[model samples]
Target: MPRALSTPPVIAPGSLGGSPQPVLPVTGGLLLRPWEEADVPAFLSAYQDDEIRRWHTRRPSTEGQVQEWFEAYRQDWKHEKGGHWAITCDDDAEVLGRIALRGLDFDDGMAGVAYWVLPAARGASVAARGLRSLTTWALAEIGFHRLELDHSTRNHASCRVATKSGYLLEGTKRSAAVHDDGRHDMHLHACIRGH
Candidate 1:
């Protein structure tokens, strides 16, 4: 016969999917909130930017596709598969960027982090701020053990964001990521709980 478990799960089943994801606040009054119907336009427009499209190869060509993505994001959140948020400001409330924890492995107590900032939000440390806020929520607030972030080796901005957010450089994965330009090496970074 099999023996009963000694220790409980690190994250209870209902702990994440049971409740709504909260609006995480960043410095400079920036906030990370769930995407809404109103954000569809901005989300679509982001793909047209050369830099955004360069790294994020997937693009939503039409309103329908954007809406479909929103549905998928909501489903991911409901099932604890992922958590995605829109980075906005207190005064404007418009989408300045996005940060997400994808590929959540509750059993292993880890998740993958990803983010992008719009052109208007580029100069400020928006991505780093959003990343830090999300990291706190995922590690400290939710009790996850680690969060991993991977970006194209050529994406200097993303590397800076990960480093600025306290994600240590682990190593590079050769030809691990494919962009519209072509296959590229990926730099892996990680941040564990408790600083």
Candidate 2:
């Protein structure tokens, strides 16, 4: 027997892909904006950072790869699969880091959060600020029910960011992420709407 449908989907299909991704403002004179063609150099430079490279192994290396990635990011916004942003100061446009909503599922009102700050931008709570701003847009401005943050267990900084941003620790997924050294456990954290 088929069950009758009672509740509607948390988010409607095309509701996200139909609209242009917005530029978000973070406290401390920070802004999260869409990637641009001119940001290629800074974007590639981030890959050279040991911390960024180790955690985010899947990254564009060359100009061609980054170009392809830029095109893909545009398409992802249109398709509602993901949203990417460059973290920069409101006054200075130099790319300070990267942050994104990956594997967005509109029907479930869920998405994964990921981010990294440049060496120069570290220890300023940049990641936490950007994450809080994005979470507000996702939960309050829009209508997402939940957002998940996962990072390698060895990444203590990320754990701090997640907690500071109000994402409660859910649990651990053992051997979930494969870093350059080896597989590492991942800590999962999440925030629900109105919490």
Candidate 3:
């Protein structure tokens, strides 16, 4: 059955300090939908970019690896785990970026978010809209209570986005993980649903 687009179950407008509406359809030159096999090439191209790879756990260095991840992305949605959508613009349908909800824990009412926009798409508010759409859907439709997003301490841009999007700046963990160069600090953000 196709998911109907309707006002989600229960989201108090004042929860986020404004009248929050359920996510609108893809507008403003961006379309977000589930991943497809053909999106492998686009995913590879996006992930391979040096700037994006800096925060990514592992970069897709080979076509075969990208192919595998692409398949896994499909399986994620199929198996009710978590996944992302290709951020395409309406004018050219250009796959300019991606936003994802991975590591879902349904029983605990939580999920982790990750996203990136091509450098060309930066400063265009694509990331904010993408995150809002996905998070609203996850909270109201998917019955999740809290959404979590973590970014490296040095990635101030991500921190600003998270805060601006109603995510509370929880705290920072020192030496939370190791990157290619050395230990990295992690800043965590979270949003809890309203009754």
Candidates' RMSD to native: 2.2, 2.4, 8.1
Tens-place lDDT per residue, model 3, 1-195, is: 935545553432223223222223455756786566677778788876777888886788777897777777766766656666777775665777888888776556677998888888889878877787777777877668999999899988888878877889999989997777788999999988882
Candidate 1: give the clashing pairs.
none
**Residue 122 of model 1: what lDDT?**
97
Regions more than 4 Å wrong, model 1: 1-7
The Cα RMSD in angstroms, rounded to one decimal, for candidate 1 relative to the true structure is 2.2
Worst 10 residues of 1 by lDDT: 2-11
Alpha carbon deviation, residue 12, candidate 1 (Å): 1.4
Q: Which ten residues in a row have the lowest lDDT in candidate 2?
A: 2-11
In lDDT terms, how accurate is model 1?
A: 0.91
**Model 2 bad stretches (over 4 Å):** 1-6
Q: What are the per-residue Cα lDDT tens digits for candidate 2 across 114-195? A: 9999999999999999999999988887689999999999999999999999999999999998888999999999999988
Model 1: per-residue Cα lDDT at residue 140: 88
Q: What is the lDDT of candidate 2?
A: 0.91
TM-score of each: 0.95, 0.95, 0.82
